[model samples]
Target: MFAENKLTDDMAEIEAFLVRERAKVLSEAEWKFRMRGYGYNLRRTNGGVEVARLPQNTVLGTLAL
Candidate 1:
């Protein structure tokens, strides 16, 4: 049916959007890890992937104290 097809198309579009957003997050994480000595981790959850930044030992890190 037309409604079913429309639903499928909508699902595909949503999936594509999530993929793009995930890619962007990964790219930014990679850049930060490489250029700024930042640490990161990607974990899978019931909802979706979670991008987390690990603590880094930096001058600025201590300044926050």
Candidate 2:
């Protein structure tokens, strides 16, 4: 576990974060690239937040290709 190894604290800050992030218009090509790379679909919600939904059955890992 991360805590056992003291790798990170319970309230550690994330590497890339959004502090009051505003949504920017993304073109079709840009959107597709984002989806393929991270499996996330982004859309503007009524609440003014860029909602990103992850695809199902998608698992993330680090392995050599």
Candidate 3:
């Protein structure tokens, strides 16, 4: 028991968003570079490597090196 028209409109909006922003999507490296300016760093984890945001003071001090 559901409204079919409501579901159709929701799906249409999602499709439209994907189509419009398809070209604006960033590559993995691009994303890393962009976020790096905000104090994020890549680190090794038990499972795999991941990017994390460090404390502002610590990041700034490291960058001064």
Clashes of each: 0, 0, 0
Give the per-residue Cα lDDT of candidate 3 at 44: 38
Estimate every model's Cα lDDT from 0 to 1: 0.35, 0.31, 0.36
Worst 10 residues of 2 by lDDT: 13-22
Q: Which stretches of candidate 2 lie over 4 Å from their true place?
A: 1-32, 57-65
How high a TM-score does candidate 3 get? 0.32
| Pairs of residues at least 3 apart in sequence or in different chains that clash in candidate 2 | none
Among these predicted structures, which one has the highest TM-score? 3
Q: Model 1, residue 44: what's the lDDT?
A: 48
lDDT of 1 by residue, 1-65 (tens): 01222432243443443344446555745533442332324344565444343453211111000
Cα lDDT tens digits for candidate 3, 1-65: 01122322243442343233334546645544544553445343564434343443222111100
| TM-score per candidate | 0.27, 0.29, 0.32
How do the residues 1-65 of candidate 2 rate in per-residue lDDT, one tens digit apiece?
12222333222221122111112325645643544444333344454324233555222221111
- Return the lDDT, model 1, position 31: 39
Stretches of candidate 3 off by over 4 Å are 1-24, 43-49, 54-65
